[model samples]
Target: MSCPRTKPAWSSLLGNSRLTTIPIICFGHLSIMVQVGDEIPSISLCEENPSDYVDLKKELAEGNGLIIGVPAAFSPTCSDTHIPDYISSPSLSSAGKVFVVSVNDAFVMRAWGKSLDKEKKSGIRFLGDATGAFTKALSVDFDATSALGNVRSKRYAIKTVNGKVSGVFIEPDNTGLDVSAAQKILA
Candidate 1:
């Protein structure tokens, strides 16, 4: 695929001193965001530690599962609202193997997970996309450099059955606390 050279947009909000929007420059391929019926990507994500890797392709292929993608590990909305809903949702038990992924290192993810579920009662596993390969493969990544320091996954809830996407709930605002909320998906 040939990438088109598009001009960057300058914003008056910054006195037009710098480009506000960065054009998408594809090197050899264009990534289309994941859609329904898409199979889970065979990417290895970090689990608790850098050396501990977990691949969901095989696990998700066998049963129902939920993958919750967040922008950061301990951000305000993510820590206070988003993940707590899933952790406390009664219906989440039936959702099968629930995994929460973030574009953070394994240590941060592990610490955040423990802080939320001290007793590990949630049964939700926290995984790290340290290099964001998993998020990029899913095409759910967004440039969050302004707020979160780097590219991050948009808030999303993906339901999987037999390793194929059954439902996808992505927040329209990228980092909003709606649509992908547990109340909506778990119901």
Candidate 2:
């Protein structure tokens, strides 16, 4: 026969008024965004066409890389300028493996990637954070329900070295292209 159920140690500790109260740290309420020196999270991002998944943490650990976070794929600024900058920039060849991450699905990201790099000449990899898990792990995902009817990643770029962020540029309003631009980051 199974013994009677008992409250866990945590519950007993919580009930002990005599024990000093310790404040718990809550990341859910944190408003801070990802910053330099933060380690990249081991989240999987997807790619379409042939269909594959990449673990960002593993990528980071393998070598230096750049992660560009955008609000959405095919949006005016993202389509017209942001991604194109990296595609056309000479520095891109030397910027290490580059990833363009968005909250869209794999199909949309694949199409957008093809549109941006029809010849696949550029090495930029378009990644779909379909569930926003990777984006949230970076602390760069934001609620864009009003504008996009879903949560999305803020505009940002992170330069990573062996899984650790060496540099970061995050757009203040999540809509601007000033800070996270390739020119600015390369400069």
Q: Against the unseen true structure, what C-alpha lDDT does each candidate score? A: 0.91, 0.86
What TM-score does structure 2 among the candidates reach?
0.82
Q: If candidate 1 were superposed on the true structure by all CA atoms, what would the RMSD be? A: 5.7
Give every collision pair in model 1.
none
Error of 1 at 144 (Å): 1.1
In the range 24-71, model 2's lDDT, one tens digit per residue, is 443445545677888888888898842588887888785779999999
**How well is each residue in 19-122 modelled by candidate 1, as lDDT tens digits?**
65556766644788889999999999998899999998977988899999999999999999999999999999989999999999999999999999999899
Clashing pairs in 2: none
